[model samples]
Target: MNSSMDLLQNYIQSFGYDWLSNVLLITTGSFFLWVIWRLIYGRLEALADRTQLAWDDLVIKAVKAPISMLIWVWPATVSVGLVLATHSNDDVVWLGKIDLILVISTFIWISLRLISNVEAHVLDQKKRDETTVQAIAKVARLFFVTIGILTIMQALGLSLSGLLTFGGVGGLIVGLAAKDLLSNFFGGMMIYFDRPFKVGDWIRSPDRSIEGTVERIGWRMTIIRTFDKRPLYVPNSVFSNIVVENPSRMLNRRIYEKIGLRYDDGDKIDAIVDEVKAMLEQHKDIDATQTLMVNFDAFGPSSLNFFVYTFTKTVNWARYHEVKQDVLLKIMAIIKKHGADIAYPTQTLKVDPIAMARDAEQPVGIVER
Candidate 1:
């Protein structure tokens, strides 16, 4: 052992300390790193299996322990090996540079894994009611990527001040080029914070109207799947600018309808109004707190028109329709019971061609030749 050590020392000395120290250091560091990695990874895998938490499972899935080990161990081994073998000479400068790169890369990888874990955790929490979680996740990812890029630049020996100066100029140019993109990005943030609507909400805008369930909130747009199974992509900018009507948020939906009666049936208007109000009051879905008004709204050319205005407690289309149908059926029954009749527009006219020709031939009370 003593002779082996002496021979190793002599060989290392003759070969120039830089090369020999690097080799020895790298080999030793790699061996130890492998042992530690195997032990830690095995234990973590076991722990992950025993835990019932889904976020832990996500962590295991997001990060490949073997790949992480390789990335972390290799550069550290080479850096230490070169420093020990060459006594920190210029020949190992390349190894230092590689080491810096590796460190930056590892940090990025770990940060990504951490972000994934955070997203998983946030999704797991049921109390986070906003559907904008996906938008939030995207913003977080961008932030982490920016940090990673800055770290890599620093590792490359680039001064942060100069890099930041260039980045500011580049950002201005890029922002100008992607004005719509910036609008969308800020719009997404507004959507998340302002929370105009949420997933599963039915919304309508002035220009665009659709009854859909919000599918997902993305970084630039919000996706909605209509009842007909068509996907709608609405830009966040438009959402911020447009008037959004969220039907789902309404406590009740107002319904206004008109029914016409024969002009001769004007005497029955008061009775019809009373019957309609009774029918509305008996409706299961009608809001009792709302004023059910039946008023004589118009005198048409051939009919006496009355209007019924009420609110339905439920916003569901089918349920509202069902309630309206029941009310109409009740109204019809009441009208028939009272022997009253609805009216349709009609007209009568007379023509006298002979009399019109005689009148044209001579003025009234004047003699004609």
Candidate 2:
């Protein structure tokens, strides 16, 4: 490498372009670096694809753009420093500062990209909760960004101790000015830690008209897709105050129903109740371990009312309804098997023969005229 560089320098000097020697050398070096990067990138990606571990692939992807930028940037800066060296030491000093800034920025960019890659990888597995992964990603991004800014500031000859002191005072004012923003941020943090509901979970708030499947959880808000396909942007702070019900996490879905039979079939209530209870116990979908009840609950004004209370093994909304429908149909069949019928609202009237005769005798004279 030294012999080749010397040969190139001698050739440039022979052309009486010794002033452009550094520029040509820098361009040549940058071009070679670009060529090298292109040659290795494809091989690295192919190798990463064959491996089980994802860190290698993530690293390769994260470094690609930064490395590409650095190849040209480092060379150009070095060439500029060499040119400035002959003029003023102060000019070279600024160039060094520029290089330091570029290095810090590149590091920051690579770190952020790696974080994003990791987040995508975890989500693709479909195992971890997306909300949790995103939360972690956000925290990581914030941490890296803060560190990078502070680092660059220090590299630029800024005093860290004074900055820290100023930050401590400014933070209080910023906190007060952005109270709601901070509350929402902390609310989001609480959600990440407590995890009452996650992305894709069906959630509803009893205290408010919030009912939807969670789509995304951000630092200040959560996106929810409602049943009607409407998108709801809910502030995270609101979740901290409401009673949220996560139906998606339920162990079983309840089935409660009231069945009324005709007063004439009152005698068959015991038999029907007993058979219903037995049916529920034998049902594959119904959870026998839960509170199951089929009993003659009350005597309606014109009917004998009974209630069926049970829980289904399935928490799926559609499947639970199907099971409920089957159970209801079975109950109807049992009622019919016992020659009984379901009750409806009705009334009865009775008349005395003596009162009817008295009314007929009093109205006869007007009819004759």
Candidate 3:
């Protein structure tokens, strides 16, 4: 027993014993973490397969379970064991500082990954709904990066208040330099809250007179896909200030036009109006509740002008055009059936035949003919 004790004491005194113990601890911790990772990943995969929710699958795909698990668990386990292995007081202090850094970094990494997972899962639900999720994802990423930076600085023994003061001064300068940018950023927030238009909505602005589908509402700008298949990036500030018309939100739209008839055809004006009102009532695309008016608006020099107004039940541009074309064709046929003609600008020239005859009769007198 004395010999065994002596041998144990000798081993403890040697540097090799301490190194070996640390190695064993590290290996054990690593193996334990690996096992935990495999178990958790396996369970997550199984749950994803069995669940009816597609978002779960998205979460798994986004987080990449194995990588996420390692990011969280590896540092924690290693730091714990390293803290336990320290002997001297100075060594313990150094190990504590190292552990602090490891813990903060690990937490930051995990937080960032979790945010990514949430974004990916939400976006995978639908294409149009992804716009809001994408914007939120950008904001979340920025927030996490800021947190990570602050945590790192704190770990390095820097005063947070001093850093905050510097950041405040810097922010003031940046704010002044980017006033328009700040305006756009706030505009984006207002747009989100106000919800004047959503992604995939077709909108028109009176000032710019641009018509397009909303593609994305971003921090500083809103992207639109124009009718001509071009992308338009309008500043959020401008979007907020403009008078926007969201045609797609309407249930129906009004169509009005004017046609001219010759003054000689005035007798048929009432009949024509009756025919038009009847035609509009019979059409499937025309709204019945709307006031369909056909009136003699004014009289022109060569023609009589009449106004026609009706409501289309469809708000779609293509469908509106189709309905309008059909109505026009029907109107033309009705006019022809009634033996009435459309008129254009015309004028009459008057000539004095008696004066011309007198001039012709006296023209040869000077020659004694």
Global lDDT of each model? 0.75, 0.89, 0.76
Candidate 3 residue-wise lDDT, 238-300, digit = tens: 977789988879977888989888888899988997998889998999998888888888998
Better of 2 and 3 by TM-score: 2
| TM-score list, all predictions | 0.72, 0.89, 0.74
Whole-model lDDT, model 3? 0.76
lDDT for each residue of candidate 2 in 1-369, tens digit (9 for 90 to 100): 224333544454456554567578769978998999988998999999999998999999999999899889866766665555546666345666777788889999999999999999999999887988998999999999999999989988899999999999999999999999999999999999999999999999999999999999989999999999999999999999999999999999999999999999988989999999999999999999999999899989878999999999999999999999999999999999999999999888899999999998885455554
Residue 75, model 2, lDDT: 68
Q: Sort by lDDT, best first: what order?
A: 2, 3, 1
Overlapping backbone residue pairs in candidate 1 total 7
lDDT of 2: 0.89
Q: Over the stretch 1-369, how does candidate 1's per-residue lDDT look in tens digits?
A: 224333444554565556656466556766777777667777887898998877676666556653556545654544454445445444434455555666667666766776777776877786676576666667778888888888878777789999888989999999999999989988988878888888778887766685578888777888989889899998888876678878889888788888888877888889888878877888788897887888889988888899889999888888888888877788778777778887888775787999888889995687789
Cα lDDT of candidate 1 equals 0.75
Error of 1 at 134 (Å): 2.1
Q: What is the Cα-based lDDT of residue 360 in candidate 1?
A: 95
Worst 10 residues of 1 by lDDT: 1-10
